[model samples]
Target: MGNINPSLLHVGSTLGAVFMALMVIFIRLKASARPVTLRKIWIPPLGMSTGFAMFVVPEVRFPWWWAVTAFLIGWFIFAYPLMRSTVFEERDGLIYAQRSKSFAFILLGLLLIRTVLHEFINRYVSIPQSGGLFFILAFGMILHWRVYMYKRYTRMALPKAPIPQPRG
Candidate 1:
C-alpha cells in the first residue's frame, strides 16, 4: 500500500468527492449559524471534517477487499440512512443534514472506486488512484456524518419532547 496525495488527482476528476465535501461544509455552516434553536449543531460538521481530514493520513498496507469491506460497513452504519432522510426544519441553527449526505456518499464512492480500480481495473482503465491509511479514516468520517444526521433524523422522527411552541 502507498500514500496518495489528493492533490495528485485533478480537482475535476474527483468532482463527486469534492462536491460532497463542500456540501457537507456548506450545510453545516448554514445549519449551525442560523437563528434556529438546534439542540446540537456540532454533530454534522464534525463528521464532515473527520472524513475530509482522512485524505492525508499516513500509509498502511492492507488487502484490497479489506478496504472496501471497511468502507461499506461504515456506510451501512452511518452514510446510507443519513442520505435517505430529508430535512424539513432545524430546531437549532443547523443546516439540513441530508443535503450534506451526498458528500459522504461521494467520498465513500471515491474510496471504493479507487480501491477496486487499483486492484482490478488499473490494468485497463488507465486512471490515477489514492490509497492507504487515509481510507480507513475517510470511511469512519463517512459514518460519523451519518451518525450526525441520524441523530437529527431520529430526534425528528421519534420525539416526545414537547415541541416548545415558539415564543412570538
Candidate 2:
C-alpha cells in the first residue's frame, strides 16, 4: 500500500538478524552452569529497554487499546512460555537456571509471525505506529520475563532454615 515504506523493510530485517545473533549468544550463556546472580537477571531487561527506546518516536500516535492488546499478546506468547520453560535450582547455596533451547525455536517462530503481521500492518498503518506497537510488545514480554526471573532467583537464593538443636 501507499503507506508502506520500502526502507522500513530493510531496517527491520537487519535489526532482526542482529537480534537473532544476540539471542543465540544469550541462550548459550544462560544455559551455562554459572551461578545465577541479581546482576545477570537484571541485564537482559536493561538491554531490552535500550532497544525499545530506539523504536519510540515522538510523532507516533498509537491507540491505548492497541498498546494494551500488544502487551497482553506479548506477555502470553513470549513471557509465559519462557517462564514456564526455565528450570531453576539451588545447589551449594547458589542459584542456577537451566535455559531451554526450545525457547530459541519458539522465539524464532514468534519473530516469523510478527514479521508476517508487520507486512500486513504496514500496508494499513504508518511505520512509526507499527514500530511503536512492536516496542511496547517487546517491552511487555521482557519486563514480565525479568520480573519472574528475579522472583525465582530470590526465592532460590534465600537462606535455608537451620535445623533445630536437640535439647542438651
Candidate 3:
C-alpha cells in the first residue's frame, strides 16, 4: 500500500492466493483414491483464494459500501462449502481423512470473521511489531501436522507381514 496501486495489489494478491490455493488443494487431492479432478480441485482453491483476497484490501480501511459488497461477493462464492453433504459420496468427510479438514479450517475462519464483522480479530487493525510468537506457533503446528500427514499418507508403520509357515 505504501507504493503499490489497487489494481496491482488486486492482481498480485489474487495470483498469490491462487498459487497458495493450488498448493493446499494439491495436498488435499493427493489424499484421494482417484486422480485429481478439475471440479473437485477448484472447490478448495476457490474458498481459499477468496479468503486470501481479503488481505489485499489496502490500509485495511475499506469504504463502507465496498467492504460490504466485497463481503457479499466472497460470501456468495464460498457459501456452499460451509455445509456438509450426507448424501454425496463424492464429498470429503472426516478430519484430515479427506479434504474435509481444509474446508473445516476455511469455514471456521470465515465464521470467526462473520462474528467480528464490525472489527477484526484483534482490537487494533494497523499495528505491526512482533509476529514471531505467531510464526513460532504456526511453525509448530505445521511441523506436527506435516509429520502426521506424511505418516498417515504413506502408512509409515504398518505391522510387518507374518512369516509364511514352511510348507513341507
Candidate 4:
C-alpha cells in the first residue's frame, strides 16, 4: 500500500466532522418541526449500530482498554450535557423534541473538542485506530443520550393511572 499523507488525512477528517455537525444541526431542526415518535427516538442509535462493522478491518482495531476508556468518557462526560440540553414537550397530544437554546452550541463545542483531540491522538496512533476510538466514544455518547431520551419519552407517552376517590 502507498504511504498516506498525514496532512491530507487531518484536513479530510476535520472537514468531515464539520460537515456532519452541520447535518446534525439541520436534521434536528427538521425533526423538531414534527411530532416525535418511539420509532424516531430509537432509529439513530440502531442505525448507527451498523458502524460497528468498521472493527472488522484490521487497521481499525484498538486495545480493549482504550475502547473502554473512550466509551466511559463519552458516556459520563459528554452525554451529560447532551441529555440536559435535549428535552421533550407535548403539544396537541403528541410528543416532540423541544428546541433547546444550548443544543447547537453544545454540538459545536463537541466538534471542536473532537477535532483537537483527533490531532493530538493521531500523533501516537494510526489514523484508523484513532478513528475507531473516536467512533466508540461517539457511539457511547449517542447511546447514553438516546436511552435517557427513550426513558423520558416512554414516561411521558404512557397513560397516567387515575387515583381512587374517597366515598362521600
| The best candidate in terms of TM-score | 4
The count of backbone overlaps in candidate 4 is 0
List candidate 3 segments past 4 Å from native.
1-97, 101-127, 154-159, 163-168
Compute the lDDT of residue 89 as modeled in candidate 1: 64
Worst 10 residues of 3 by lDDT: 127-136
Local distance difference test, candidate 2: 0.74
Q: Candidate 4: minimum summed lDDT over ten consecutive residues — where?
A: 1-10
Q: For every model shown, what is its TM-score relative to the native structure?
A: 0.30, 0.76, 0.32, 0.95
- 83-158 per-residue lDDT for model 1 (tens digits): 5543546545434443444545554565555455444633532233233333453556455655555576567656
Worst 10-residue lDDT window for candidate 2 reads 52-61
Tens digits of per-residue lDDT for model 4 on 43-102? 999998899999999988988999999999899988998999988999999999988878
Ranked by TM-score, the better of candidates 2 and 4 is 4
Q: Which ranges of candidate 4 are over 4 A from the true structure? A: 1-3
lDDT of 3 by residue, 59-82 (tens): 444345544444454444334343
State candidate 2's TM-score: 0.76
Q: Which segments of model 2 are wrong by more than 4 Å?
A: 1-11, 14-18, 21-31, 51-56, 162-168
Q: What value does the lDDT take at residue 45 in candidate 1?
A: 46
For each candidate in turn, give its C-alpha RMSD to the true structure in angstroms. 13.0, 3.7, 12.7, 1.3
Q: Which whole-number lDDT from 0 to 100 does residue 73 have in model 3?
A: 43
For each candidate in the order shown, give its overall lDDT on alpha carbons. 0.50, 0.74, 0.40, 0.91
Per-residue C-alpha lDDT of model 2 across residues 1-168, encoded as one tens digit per residue: 356576876487648755974775586555557988888878877877776554455645677899899898888776786677677877787778776777666667667777788778778877777877777787788788888989888777777789999999
